[model samples]
Target: MAIKMGTGDLAKYPFLNEAGDYLRQSGFDWEELDRPDTREILERAEERLRTAVAGNVYEKLDRYETEILTFVVTLIMVKSIGLDPVLKKYALAEARRAEKFLSEDLRRQSDAQRRALFIKIFEDLFGLKIDVTEDGRLFKVRVTDYLRRSSHFHEQEWKMINRLVQAGQVFLDADETVRLIRNELAILIINKVRGMSLPTLPNSLVERVEQMRAELTPRFEYRTQVVTEYPPCIKHALDVMNRGENLPHSARLMLATYMLAIGKPVDTIVEIFKNAPDFNERITRYQVEHLAGSKGSRTKYSVPSCEKLRAENLCFATAECDGIVNPLQFGKKRANKK
Candidate 1:
């Protein structure tokens, strides 16, 4: 049976390795249907991994890069909703705590030493001078400008970067060396970028990496502030995971929304009901009702009006609906729609 995962495990622990070995060594059937790389059109993963490995790509990454990749996808969850601790702080603080869970060599490294190592490794990655602040441990660096100016908005790239960071961190914990992890980082970075069929690496990408490296300038900046953390989508996934439904959370939620929005209440109900043999009508009704709350449960339930949508921060839906004058916004058409 699969083990239950909680927020702490999902966020703190990595979901990697072991599977390939199990599949090869123990005769486990690999699910070909599931894929880590979604951008198949841009880059076929098999071709890239081979080339990246040949380049001696896996050895030279710095701590930060590896840490980022291992834990990158979590940012999506974080961005979708708010994070429990605003990331800038957690990034620095947890770097230490995570080590116990990190290394197979857990006998050594007391908490004090770990904290010191956290500060040292963090600073080394993207250099920043640190100071303890009244609110919490703070590091002064321009994350705002970084976030705005950076091209990291793309989900695919975000996953790649985070994966590298995680790997580098693990290597650092195992070995007491503070060497640049560029090669190890290259393994991930090259593989991910290779996934793309971009004709060339934009000069701008190189420049931005350089600029960020400068800002990190011999130190990583960490701070605790009221920050907008997590994405709406990721938060939704966590919420759904808590429900423990057999269907993937994302699939179920998307289906629920499209079904409700397009005027197929019974079909949605029948579908979800069938899936959720343990379905709770009250819970289902609560979710549907709470959304566009005033509307009753009916075929023509009131789609939120333009003004209502705007006031309620529904611009994304609001814009789509404007054109929707909603044609074929229903039943069978949906399977063929998106």
Candidate 2:
């Protein structure tokens, strides 16, 4: 038998089966969403959508039931709006929110409880089994499972070669384990939302859905034209992002820095990321500005050298890249020849 989660647990992770069971057992009907008594739920749902749009976590209500219901209503609202970007954004935000609570839960539980909870959560929710080392200081996951989940991570540190593995199992600390599952959780939520069949929303809820659509829609005016002067690596990164695929963090940093080095406006660089699968305008804008030296440390960052990029597997070197140590130097020789 699977370990059952309490209402509080369900509230933290409303995507759990227990939360869905709870809502169904409560006899809550879709028509009730427009009732005056359910206005609080509707309002909370709207707030959840807005918070996600702004790239922030939605706060949980004092009542666990309210939290669970609000999550359901939020999903209904997101599904009714039927915008792909909004669905992706909400799924990402909800997953992050769950991660925050999960991290807190793991830290607060005693060692024995933490181990059991961690194992149970992974096994039950993700069908992935996790084990604690004999000393209980490290978590162990099968190499195959690690490879599947770690594919979502683009950092060099997540590469299998960099991991501590023995006897077909990869070793990771508690925090790292949690971080590895964040994308899985997001994907799960997205799948669930996509599978839902929502009824025609009441007028009140329809109006709110329209409001959410207006707010979450991308309104960027910048059109991306291929800059022939850009090196292959930068162009590849832009192509990945334009196709709405996830770009590796190193590539994103390189692209941002290289663009900034060539005097591209911060807004233009930020707009370039609008088509990213996980794009959050607020977070992207902040990061682009930071790279531009307008935020944190206020020190302009430079594009990584070709050698560093190659080491990180981010390089797409061609004959044109010859003798160019950094991406900024890619088109210089050609310009000089002209």
Candidate 3:
């Protein structure tokens, strides 16, 4: 594959990693697939869509690029009949790409190859797995057989198969799979560009992407005010973790669970821990997902109480910590006061 540098206004996006640039240069852009960017794109798309209640200005974007823009807006933007034309247009385009990508050899390809390709494209574009459902027994069994024979299979892959037991079956045929994957890629690309303000582009062109982004992105109030509500112990743990200090397992769990309980998205929680002394994206994602009830027992963890933190010697009491047992209680008290 040819490796190309990031281009257009996407290179300026604040949260994109070097990997995203590399992938884009290689002709597959998975930009804005991260939690922050995805949220931003959704926000922008929503705002732009609302402003243009009448019609879009319709700048001429590349067919593939436009399809991606349209998908992100339609998918993330609020669910309404207003976006049906844009959604159908890009969805059909993505479907065509999916058909071409799958070709006639889909049946002939080994299940392992199919599984591998499916996983790679999804991960490459969205940094996410296409969840396998209980209905996908044939697909799951084939993938499991392949993993059993492959030494490269690790705990993450193992967990994916486990998740397959519960996820909804979305892949009906090879073409459908391709179409879905392509649609996601389009969203990823749009997320990268539209999530970040388009620098140096003509207002008309930028508006086009933003309009699409607005259509797909949803509206939500910013949670910036939540910082003041953090309990002293959880706040301390976060500060120490951010400084690359080694935290006890209990401390880590408390922080992770506390953040999750506060309605912080999994991605945001994971990003907060990225600065920890031993941060591994795969391991971190698995652990966070596990705590957030996306994996394993599906039981969302609660933050440890003052008593538990004291037991672990992870407690850092301050004036704000007075009489507080659990972090959630602390937050609730503050909210109730307001």
Candidate 4:
């Protein structure tokens, strides 16, 4: 049976097709947004962008129509600004917001509603179906679909070999299922926003758009020269990220710490990760900054030792690495010899 989403559901998930239908039914006019009466809509749209850029979740409004309209307006503003980082940031934030609500609904809603929402979000939107286990404590997805979605996750727990698979299905809990859907939602929003081509914005939105561009534009000084001294493991990590593949979490930590150890700017390291399929600029920036000792603990991180890397299956050591215990020591002896 098809699930019918009400205005409340659409408000919580404005990226849904039903939300678009709601907008069309409401006869929302872009021009009408210029009037003072619609100022709240514009303000909420700006707030959405501001929160997204700040790496925080935007609070949904009390009225469902207003929430839906602000989402559309937010997209228009993001499109108008024409910044890839901002677009990605906004999409990720929106996806996370939806994920939060979905988690709440899955936990609190009646059994029938929860199941319906699960099917509506996963099967209807993402074309991936999940079945509840006989005990009803876990969900099961086909191995094919599981691999397709889980590939985006860098955590070891999400790895197929670590999962419990029976026959053709892989088991997941409600939280895990929702987590996978979050990635799908983010990608869906990113593609949708990228494909939009907006006309000239009304005068009311022009100033706010300029403000967003000024605030969100990255302005860090970074080295342009390519460093050829990267060790094999670092090179492999870079290659994986540059190829838009998911780098394992441990490898990613090793790569970031190694780059920081070699004096790479946080912005530069963050830029390198832009090619990653699951890159979220806000999270990347935060993690890179944390490793750089600019955030948290205030203690800079160091590259993992070669022994640890080997244990993690991240080492690609050659004869050149014979004397080095840490990645930072890779070219030390060679450089000293020269």
Best by TM-score: 2
What TM-score does structure 3 among the candidates reach?
0.33
Task: Give Cα distance to truth, residue 278, candidate 1, Å.
Answer: 20
TM-score of each prediction: 0.24, 0.87, 0.33, 0.80
Name the lDDT value of residue 288 in candidate 2.
94
Question: Higher-TM-score candidate among 2 and 4?
Answer: 2
Instruction: Kindly list the per-residue Cα lDDT of model 3 for residues 38-106, writing each as its tens digit.
Output: 444444444434333222222223333333443344334323322333333333333343446444434
How many backbone clashes can be found in candidate 4? 0
In terms of lDDT, the best-performing candidate is: 2
- Candidate 3 C-alpha RMSD relative to the actual structure: 15.7
Query: For model 1, what is the alpha-carbon lDDT of residue 296?
Result: 58
**Ranking of predictions according to TM-score:** 2, 4, 3, 1
Query: How do the residues 112-224 of candidate 4 rate in per-residue lDDT, one tens digit apiece?
Result: 78779877787888998878776667788899998887776656698788999999999987788788877778889989988888966788888888876776555312213
Q: After superposing candidate 1 on the true structure, give the runs of residues whose Cα lies further than 4 Å from its correct spot.
A: 1-131, 134-261, 266-286, 289-338
Task: Return whichever of 1 and 2 wins on lDDT.
Answer: 2
lDDT, each prediction: 0.31, 0.81, 0.48, 0.81
